[model samples]
Target chain A: MLPTSKSCILCETEARKIYAAIFGGEIPLAVLNRFVVATQRLNANVPPAETDAYYRALLACDDLEALEVAARYTRKLPLLTRKFRLMAYLAETVPETQDFFINDRSNLLAGLWAAFTGGLRTAVKLPAGLWLLRRCAHV
Target chain B: MSELIIVGSGAAGAAAALALADLGLRPLLLDVGHTDPGAGPRVEGNLYDYRRRHDTFGLYIGEDLHGLSDVLTGETGIAKLNAPNAAFVVQDAARLSPVEASGFDAIQSFALGGLGNAWGAGLYRFVDADLAGFPLRAADLAPYFDRLTGEVGISGAGDDLTPFFGATAGLQPPLRLSYNADRFYRSYAHRRAAFLAQGIQVGRPRLGVLSQPRDGRPGCDYSNTEFWQDAPYLYTPAVTLRKLIAAGQIDYRPGVLVRSWTETAAGVVVDATDAATGAALRFEGRTLLLAAGAIGTSKIVLRSFRDYDTALGLLENPAVQIPFVLPASIGRRLDAQAFGLTQLNLVWESPDHGRLQGSLLELTSPMRAEFFMRFPLAARANLALVRSLLPAMLLMQLFYPGAAQPPAQLSLREDGTLRIRGHENAISVRELAPLLGLMRSAGLWTAPMLIFKPATGHAIHYAGTLPMTESPARYQCDPTGKLAGAEHVYIADSASFTALPAKNMSFGMMANAMRIAEAAARR
Candidate 1:
């Protein structure tokens, strides 16, 4: 029934405080339930603002190892941003052999550059279901 | 008539042109390359290959005369070898050989804008350590920094050098961090304080891009792979040349290369040859400034004073590259380039969350090796190999490679020409350019050395040959940027650089050139 049940490779576990901290301040009320469901799928159903704060905290506090650990549990791209294109790019393409996270890394930025630059052109036809892509590293 | 006659059109030469324009005295600005006055984007080499993902990696096995290029031997030596089809003024010139021991300024750049066309727009200034043995200070260059930022339009954040000098010349609101950059963010913005324990400081890159745009230049589109190819995004000096021409400050002379300059008691006279027709024309001036780049200006000096300065050897400097892998998880985080300094990360840990002194905050992006995967490689047997393994090349340059290069020598051959030998992980320019690429070297044989081992060198960070210093052992220019030996010659280039070139040498070089012109104008 959940997205992670199908695509996620990492083990799904109960969400930590960091999860709630990453989805900080901004989330439309209509999509809040969808975000809650996606996280519930990852068992990371913390509050949105907490998720964002945690993301920032990770930037200010955690090292790469901790960041990786957090990444593994993150099952879905935040539905609020509709960064599904980034996610699809990752899943469709084979991850790199050497740099473990490169596929995720490339797709994330390339997708963002594309989405951000193409913001005014065609937001309607976009995938991942969000006006702006976030959380998901899909290219 | 003049003190020095500089040749070539590029960063070095353009800086000279700008410097002279400020002085109110018009120095002879002749270009031998493509000096046509055409409007609109005129991209060479990049236009055809713009959209394609091509890896410019490889080796050129040939005989070269001057010790300028790095394609043949990684080392710089005066040896001649197999030549290109026909070395014309542009891509199609008459076949020519160099005269043995002929002091010729066989420098690059004949275009109206010089080498500024192919720049990536990464600008940085030297710190105290970068200055090292040099006898110059940030205060001395204060005004030039002011003048250049006013003219060139640099973008980015940080206290590296620009902030201290002050002004938001061309920075837009600040570019957004790509989601990909989070991997290297820690190593970048949130770097470990341990480096401070080791005296290492990681910061963001301060570049010359507008978060917003100004000076008639448009905002960055960010669609192109490299900024150099960002036709509509960047505002190169050629753009500035048009403005200068409109202002009636810059005169136009396409196809004219100053063959030589002879200074007499009255003034200086420059001899130029129409690169296309070989027809010689002359220009005279009260003062002269050398804008030919490091190897360029020095070669010009070599041509000017055959035995004037014995310190012209490229051997005097050896730029070193010190690279290291960021802590595991940090690699991805720090490798991401956002609106901050992705060019150079000044890493130093703070007592709290370590702060980065760079221009952009790392977000995420494809690595060089990984990005190169987009191109076709003969080595790859299948689509799987190319598709799967390409985008993982995020390597941080611990310190810019070629940290110190001895005064390199670009000899003028019998018939008249020159060459160089070099690569990048740090600058841009192809003097002995278009050398072997990093990805190619990384892909083939590197002895398993990390990116640091075979550190890269780009012509972007220009320096040495004619360093500006008060002492003979220190530099060749005065505090005001005048060449020490010559009466009226001044260098407004990296050659006048007494320190290791900073992240944005163009801005620095531009500023330095302005300073030299300011002084010359006063005289």
Candidate 2:
């Protein structure tokens, strides 16, 4: 089904905002368009009410807070879970942003630090994130 | 009418047709041949390099996002089926040949090469012990295996696996292992004596992949795109079928889906459908060979007899996936060129569980997105961690011999779809502990919690629905692969395999098919 212009604009705006929050950069128009298309396709499978709720939740979060809230919701309910498959789909299509995160020229010290901080941050936020996801998404 | 008719153009059909051609017989091969649309555009360099420069989500994950659809839909196992380019391998499988499965996660292929189109190309020969359940011994199929080894360019070294995989002539040099696998192999080599003492043997895997140019197909250039696209150097049964058709040895008819057959007074009459048009068609032949895979063949046979009540026992190797890491190899730069197929064969002789086999593979070929969604951390954190750990990660897919208890059953439903009821074939953690300890000693570390045992039928090494028996029963095939109660029909696939061993069965399936074809031709 062709995406409606109103829905497409909302998807584009949210995708750009989310991409910026997660990766801290201007989302390329090409990447943003791809994300919007993929998100809409994934949303087609989800219930309209749930899709609307998910978008409202994303809209409520400001800047990097969206990443935390999305991560918390995703961690408790996996992105591939029936309720959150669209979240995973969005993450998957934004390869341009994810590519920037891979440190191909691996530095052992840098890697260890990233892993340590990542693991610590995940542990610290997991409990509150779970509670926040339940309150925010009502899932 | 042709002298011989072969159903399906998979491993068995291809081998049967080739062997018949050797006897100066041309078989008419009917198939619902699904093929890749085309390799749209080739990736110029290695997968990593290409991905770094371009947005490869469409290429790797698929424009339709089919690569991740399985995971999204909560379908576990069958990772190969999710490949974007290889989707055609399973393109009309479910809709065309519907199956009602319970607990059994079954997958079938109607593609030109069948499942071999997306196979890992592990081509090990089964020894006599592996064939103990069959009426025929390893010697009975050795010549066919040797012939196939030469015909389908194999690459492997004669090592610790030589005893398990019988020595076959004409093997090209083995593909070079990736950095992580290479380090693991060296560690295993150093502790070989100790590991062997514990009944664990590690060696280079025999693969149906060319290391040298042969038959106009280029040798493997180690682009590490083996999982993403069709490689010319890899051996698929379709390659043999194409050669046979081009050489006027087999009249290959695509788009014909054989549903069933009946043995007539004079010959055999086959009933099929024009896949595209859904028109009923019939063909007659002097002899018929059913090689539509174990499940596919069983469905046809059950429908032919109109036996919806009778349930046939199904055989499939129970599999477990263990993802391990080498701490020392972490933070190492990824290799630009490396063979992404099975790098090492790990054989464990468990006194309680029989022989268990595992293929140790490097994790560089598949797209990182496949794993990104599954990691426990936040998206950015998970991405960073995966990037760091990917260079060191290796996956070992361990397979156990098929069991009889709480048996998996395959039966035809009244509605013409095949029904499969499967049971959990659980492997005890204690049985694998020794092997894990041995690997840990070699610096390969993995956690018990990280082990993933996919549901039954995930291995895709299905067989034994219409097994070969010395004393043939109503649904059984005789020692010569002749279907019981039928005069001119023969089973030329894994359906006639009496036992399912832990070793990969594609090579053995082809060899056994050739043996059955030769015997049928002589008769």
Evaluated with DockQ, which candidate comes out highest?
2
> What is the DockQ for all candidates, taken in turn?
0.01, 0.38
Question: For candidate 2, what is the DockQ?
Answer: 0.38
TM-score of every candidate relative to the true structure: 0.57, 0.94
Would you list the C-alpha lDDT of every candidate in the order shown? 0.41, 0.80
Query: Taking the tens digit of each residue's C-alpha lDDT, what string does model 2 give over B441-488?
Result: 998999887788888888888999888999998989998899998999
Candidate 2 colliding pairs: none
Residue B437 local lDDT, model 2? 91
lDDT of 1 at B470: 71
